[model samples]
Target: MSNAPSSPTGPVNRLAETTSPYLRQHAHNPVDWWPWCEEALALARETDRPILLSIGYSACHWCHVMAHESFEDPGTAELMNRLFVNIKVDREERPDLDKIYQTAHQLLAQRPGGWPLTVFLMPDDQKPFFAGTYFPREPRHGLPAFKQLMQGVERAYREQKTAIESQNESLMAALAELEPHASDALPERSAIDAALQQLDTSFDPEHGGFGDAPKFPHPTNLDLLLRHATDAPQTGAPDRSALAKAVWTLERMVRGGLTDQLGGGFYRYSVDALWMIPHFEKMLYDNGPLLALCCDAFAVTEDPVFRDAAVMTADWVLREMQSPEGGYWSSLDADSEGEEGKFYVWDREEIRALLAPAEYAPFAAVYRLDRPANCEGRWHLHGYRTPEAVAVDLGLEPARVQALLAAARATLYVARERRVRPGRDEKVLTAWNALMIKGLARAARTFDRPDYLESAEQALAFIRGTLWREGRLLATYKDGTAHLNAYLDDYANLLDALLELLQTRWSRADLDFALALAEVLLDQFEDPIGGGFWFTGRDHETLIHRTKPLGDEAIPSGNGVAALALERLGHLVGEPRYLAAAERTLKLAAESIRRMPYAHATLLFALDEWLDPPETLVIRAGDERLDAWRREAQRGYRPRRFVLGIPADESHLPGTLAAMAPGERPRIYRCSGTRCEPPTESLADVVKPTS
Candidate 1:
C-alpha cells in the first residue's frame, strides 16, 4: 500500500516537495493540488478565485475514499483545478487551520464536522463561505456530486458574492463567540462533582462505556475518573466505588476487538458500542494516554489485566512505532491492500490450518472464531469469552488453556506478518512524541522498568536535539527537515513530559529543557490580555482567525496542560511568575469549566490541583532506601502528590530542592501549598496530611 492516488501517471504537484505524508499521498492526483502555503494563498487572490481547502490526516479512511472517488477522476479534477485554488493540508501538521475551519463547518452545517473537510473560502480574506465533508463523485447518500457542488460553488462566488460575504461576517462572529471569556474567580468544586454525575448519567451500564455505538477510548475522561477514585481522605481509605466504572470500561476494551489480540496496540476506536468492531488505525497519541491510564488503573486496583495491557502497548510502541532516529511516528494507516482491515481480518480455514486441535479449539472458543464472522464476512479477533469460561467448555485447565491460546496467537502473528502491512505515517510530530514520552516515563516509574524510561529519554533527546533550537521548538520533522512554528500543544506537552521524565530519572539537561519550554510557552503562546494560551505561537502564520481553546479533543487541552505544567514547575523551582500564569488561566476558563466540565477534563485536572495544591515530597538520601522510599510514597494512587529523590552527592539543585541538603540519615521534606514540614525520616509522616 503506497497510499498514492489511483491516477499515478499525472505529473506531481507542489505536494511532492512537502514533508507531510498526507499531502504527498495526493501528489499524483489529477487535481492540481497545492500545499497550504503563502504561494498558494497569493495565487488564489491573484486569480480572484475561491480557495477549495481539504483538511485531513494520513490515517483517515474517508480521506482516502474521497481522494480515490473524486480527486482521482479526470473530470472532477479538471473542474476543481479550473474553478478554485485547490489547497490540501495535513490536519496533523496544521491543526490551527483545521480547528478554525472545522468549527466553521460545524456552524454552517448545524452538526459536528469530520475529515476530509471540504471548504470554499474567499481568497482575499480566506474566510470559508461553504463547507462539507466527503461528497461522492456522483450524487449519493443525500450528497450532491463533487463536480456539481464545485460548479454551484463557483457560480455563487461569482454571482451572489454579497450574500456569501454577509454569511462570512456572521460565521466569523460565531467563531469569535466560541472563545472562552475570562472570569474573575476560579471554578468551584461543584463543577467537578457535576462532571462525575454527568459521566454517570451517560455511562452505559450494559457495555461499560460512555455512550452508544461508535465508542471512542476517551482517555481523558477515564483518567479523571481514576484520579477521582484514588484521591483518598488523607488517613482513611479511598472510595472504591468510583474505580468500578473506569475499571470495567478498561477491562472490556482490553478484551474487545478495539485491542489487537495478536499484535500489541489498540485500533483508533470501536465502530460499535460492544467494542467488537474497530475503525482499525493505531495512533501514537491515543496509545500514549491509554498506556498511562492502564498503569494508573493497575496501581489503584492492583489488577494484573491493566499491567498486562500496559506491557503490551509499550512493547508495540518500542517495536513498531519508534523510529531509528529515536522519535515516535505519528500513526498507522487504516487501509491496507486497498481495503480496510485487510491486514487484520482472518478467514476460518486460515486459522484452522495454523494451529493444532488443542490450540485451535481453545483459541477459537475464546476469540469468537467458532461463531459467525464478525467483520466484513471474516473474523476480527475479540474476546467473546474469558479463558476460564472457555476452559470449562473445552474440558481443560485454565492455565493450560492460556498456554494454548498464547501459542496459537504466536503462530497467527507470524503468519500475519508475512502479509502486506499498513502504510505508516513516518513523520515525527513533537506534540504526539511528547505524549508517548509522558506515558513511557509514567509506566517506567510505576512498573520499575528501566528500559521504558530509557525509551522515553531517547525520544526526549531526539526532540531536544532536533526540534528544539534557539529557545523555541518546531512542530514536526521528517527526512531532514523540521519546520513550522511550534504550537501551544508542543511546548505545553513537552514541558509536562519533561516533568514526568524528571521524576523517573532526574537530568540537569532535561530540567533545563523543561524550563526553556515553560519560558517559551509563557512568552510566545500565552494571551496576556485574555489570560489563557493561544493555540498558535505569536510568530505563526496569519490566518482567518486566532483561536484559544479550553476543551479537550483527541488529546488533552493545551491550555489545560499548560496551566498544570506551569503550576507544577512553579512549585518545584519557586517561580511565582509561572504560578501566577497558571492561576490566571484557571480564572480565565472558570465560566467555561462550570458550564461544561465534562468537555474540560484536562482543565478540571488543573482545577483539582488549584483547589488543593499538590503535596510536594523532596527526598535527600544517601542509602538504597531512596528508590524504596519514592516507590512506597507513591504506592497508592495520589493524584495530588509529587515526589523527587536526589542522590546524596548531587549538587547545584534549584529552588526548594537545593535547600534540602542530605543529612546523616535519609530525610524527607514535605510541602503543601506554601507551608513546609520539618525534615523527617519516617515515610508514614510524610505520606500523611500536615496539620
Candidate 2:
C-alpha cells in the first residue's frame, strides 16, 4: 500500500520524500501534492500563486472520499496544479498548522471547520481568505465542483484581489483577538459550580451525553464532572448531581453502539443522540482518556459496568492497537472494503447460521440483533439488555448470562476477524502514545494489573528510545523515521505520562526523561511573561498565529497539562523552577478558566491542585503489604494524588524521598510541599486527609 515511485519516469510528487503516512498516501495521486514544508511555501510565494492547503488525516473517511473524487482525477489535478500551489498536510503530523488554519477557516467562513479542510491562502503570508471543506468533483449538494471552486478562487485572486486581501487582513485581526490578555484572576468555586450547572443544562438526561445529535465523547468535560462529583460534595457546590451525569454517560456509552460490543473499543462518535449508530472510526486519543475515566468511574460509583468498559478497551488496545514495537497506532478507519460499518455490522441470517440455537437467542436478545437493522440493512451490535435483564429473560443465573454472552462475543469476534478488517493507520504519534501510556498506567495502578503496567512501561521505553532525541522530543515516528518539531502537547503529555508511569513502575531513566521534558518545556515552549505555553516550540516555524490553547477540543488542553505536570513534578522533585512555571501558567489562563470552566477543564483541575495541592505519598517498602497498601492508597480517583512506591531495593529515589531509606519495615510518608509527616505502617493512617 505504498505510493512511492520506484523509477524516475514514474509520476510522483514531493510526498515520496516525506515520513508522514498521510503525505505518502497521496504520492501516487494525479495532483502534484507538496508536503507542508518550507519548500512548498517558498514555491507558492515565488510563483505568486495562492496556496491551496488541504488538511486531513489518513484514516478520515471524508478525506479519502475527496482524494478519490478530486485529488486522483487527472482533470481536477490539472486545475489544482495549474492555478494553485497545492499543499497537503496530515493534521496528526502537523497539528499546529491544522489548529491555526482551522481557526482561520472559522473566522473567514463563520462556521466550524472539519477534516478535508479546503482553504485558499494568500501566498504572501499564508493567511486564509476563503475556506471550505470537501467540495465535490461536480457541483452537487450545494457545493461547487472542485474545478469550479478553483477557477472562482483564481478569479477572485485576479479580479477581486483587493477584496480578498482586505478579508485576509480582517481574518488576521480576528485571530489576534482570539486570545486577549485577561486579568490573572484564578477560577474560584463559583466558576467550577457554573461549569457543572452548564453541563446539567446541556446534558442529555435520557441519552447520557451532552448536547444533541452527532455526539462526541467529551472526555475532559466528563472527567471534570467526575472531579466535581468527588471533590465538590463537601463544598455545597451548585451541581452535586454531577456524579450521576458522569456515571450515566460512561455506562450508556459502553452499552450503546459507540462501543465495539464484541471487539472492545469505542468508535469516534455517534451520529444519533442516543449514542447508537456511531461514525465507526476508532482513535487511540479517544480510547485513552475514556479508559482512564472508566477506571475512575468504577471506583467512584462502585459499578461493574465501568470496570467492564475499562477492561474491554484495555484488552482491545493490547490486542489490536498496539504495535510490535510497543507504540500505539494512530487509528482504525471507519470504513472497510468500500462501505462504512461493513466490517463490524452483521446480518441477522448470518448470525443465526453461525451460532447454535441456544446461543443465537441469547445473543440476539442481548445485543439487539432481534431489533430492526439500525445501520443500513445490518446490525451494529450494542447491548440491548443488562446482565440481570438478560438473566431474567432467559431463566438463567446472572453469572451464567455473562458467561453465555462472553462465549457469544468470542464466537462473533472470531468471525468478524475473518471479514475485511478496517485499515489501521500505524503511524505512532508521541502525544497520543503518551496519553495511552498514562491511561494504561492509571488503569494498572487502580486495578493492580501487572500486565497493563508492563505494557505501559514497554511503550514508554519505545518512546524514549525512538522519539526522544538529544534533550528534546519528536512529534511522531513512522517507518523508522522520527521528524517534525515536537509541539507543547508532546512534551507536556509525555511528562504527565512519565509521572503516571513512575507510580506503576519506578525507574531512574523515566524520572530523568521527565526532568528533561520539563526543562525543554520551560526553555522552548513557555511564554514567560504572558505565562501559558505556545502550541509550537520557540524554534519551530512561524505561523499566522501562535496559539496558547486553554480549552479542550478533540484532545485535552496542552497548557493545562503542562501546568498540571510541572506542578506535580515540582512538588515531587522539590524544584522551584517547575513550581513557578506552573503557577505563572495558571495565572495567565486564570480568567479564561473562570469564564468557561468546562472549556478550560484541565486548567480548572490544575487550579484546584495548585490552590490546595494533592499529597505525594512515597511508600518505602518491597513486601506484599507495601504493594497492597500502594493499591489501597489509590483505590479511588483522587486527581490531585500521586502515589509512588519506593521498593526497599529501589535506587535513586528522588532527593525528596531521601529520608525514606530502605529499612526492615515498610513505612509510608505523606509529603506535601516541603513538609513530610511521620512514617506510618498502617494503610489507613497514610490514606487519611491532612487537616
TM-score of each: 0.97, 0.95
Number of backbone collisions per candidate, in order? 0, 0
Stretches of candidate 2 off by over 4 Å are 1-10, 180-182, 233-240, 622-624, 649-655, 659-664, 688-691
Candidate 1 per-residue C-alpha lDDT over 133-203 given as tens digits, one digit per residue, 9 for 90 to 100: 99998898999998899999999999999999999899999999988898888889778878888888899
- True lDDT of residue 28, candidate 1: 88
Candidate 1 runs further than 4 Å off: 7-10, 232-237, 688-691
lDDT of 2 by residue, 126-213 (tens): 8888899888889899888989889988888989988887887877788888884645665565677678778889999988999998
Overall lDDT per candidate, in order of appearance: 0.89, 0.84
> In model 1, what is the error at residue 565, expressed in angstroms?
1.2
lDDT of 1: 0.89
* Model 1 per-residue lDDT at 57: 91
